[model samples]
Target: MKKLITLAAIALFSTASFAQTTWNVDKAHSKLQFTITHLAVSDVDGIFKDFTATIVSSKPDFSDAKVSMTANTASVSTDNDQRDGHLKSPDFFDAAAFPTLTFVSTGITKTSANHYKLNGILTLHGTAKAVVFELWYRGTITNPMSKADDAGFQVTGTIKRSDFGFGSKYGSPMLSDEVVVKANGEFSKAN
Candidate 1:
C-alpha cells in the first residue's frame, strides 16, 4: 500500500511538471520602449521595432512564469533618421558589433496580487548583468477575433548604460546614464 501511494505521488508530480504552458507575444499588440534624459532638459524616447518575447508557466496565476525576450539592436528607432543612424553606429549601441540584446528570467517573486519582481539577466553590448523589473500581470481574456486565451503584461525597469559599457563618451548634462525601459505585450497561449 505504501509503495502504491508513493508511485501515485510521483506520477502526480511528474504530470504537474509536464503541464507547463507557453504563451507567445503578439507583436501587433506589443511594444518595447525606452527613454533617456537628454541634456538634463529634455527626454529622448526610442523603440525596438523588431523583438520577440515568450512566457512559460504551469500556474494559473503565473507566479512561476519564466520570461524571455530578444530585441534587435539595429531596429532601435527614435523617429529621426540621423539620430537613429548614430544610435546604430559605434557611438551608442554599435549594432553591427552587438546585433541583439536579450533577457532571460532567473526567478520571480510575487510582490502582491498580480504584481511580481522579476529577476533576470540582461545581455547588452556583449555584457550580461543581473537586473530586476517590476512586472504587472494585467490578467487574461479570450480574444474576440482570435478566440484564443490571451494574457497581458507590463514590465518596467531602469538600467545604467555605463554598466553595459555603452555610450561612455556622453556623460552628465549631455545624456543621463540611466535608461528607463518599459514593455507591454499581449501573449496568446500557444498550447
Candidate 2:
C-alpha cells in the first residue's frame, strides 16, 4: 500500500507539470497599440512602450489560458508632452486613480477555424467592464532567436471613454467619444 501511494504521488506531480505550460511575454515581438480621435478628426496613434504579460495554457487552443498584463501608465506618449500630460490628468485616464489597465480572460470560445471570441473583464480607471475582443489565431512557429515555440494572435475592440468617466475634458468636438484598442501579441512557449 505504501509503495502504491508513493507511485500515485509521483504520478500526480508529473501529470500536473506536464499538463500545464507557461509562456513569458516576448516583448520584442509583441505590441499594444491604441488610436483615438484628435480634435474629433484624424486618428492619433499611440502605444505603450513598456508592458509584460504571462500566459499559462493547457492546450494550443488556449482553452485554459490565464493571462495577466501590466502597463506603465507613464509610458504613454503621443509625440506631445502637453497632450500626454492632459491624458494622464483627471480629464482622461486619471492615471493617478488608475495606474494601469488590465484584462483577464474569463472564457475563450471558438467562433471559426481561425477566429475566437475572447471574453474578459477589462479594468480601467477603477471600473471593470465586460469586454469581448475579436481575436484571430495567427498560427505558431519556432522562434529563430529563442528557439522556442511561438504563438501569435491579433485582437481588436473599442470602448467608450465616457464609460470610464473620462468625458469631462473631452471638450465637445475636440476629443472623440470612443477609443480604439489593438493588440498584437506573441508568446514564447517555455521549454
Q: Whose lDDT is greatest here? A: 1
| Model 2 clashing-pair count | 0
Where in model 2 is the C-alpha error above 4 Å?
Answer: 1-18
Which 10-residue window in model 2 sums to the lowest lDDT?
163-172
For model 1, residues 1-191, the per-residue Cα lDDT tens digits are: 99999999999998987698999999999999999999999999999999999999999899999999999999999999999999999888899999999999999999999999999999999999999999999999999998999999999999999999888889867999999999999999996
Clashes of each: 0, 0
Task: For candidate 1, list the clashing residue pairs, or say none.
Answer: none
TM-score for predicted model 2 compared with the true structure: 0.85
**lDDT of each candidate versus the true structure:** 0.96, 0.80
Q: Lowest summed lDDT over 10 consecutive residues: which window, candidate 1?
A: 164-173
**Residue 107, candidate 2: alpha-carbon lDDT:** 81
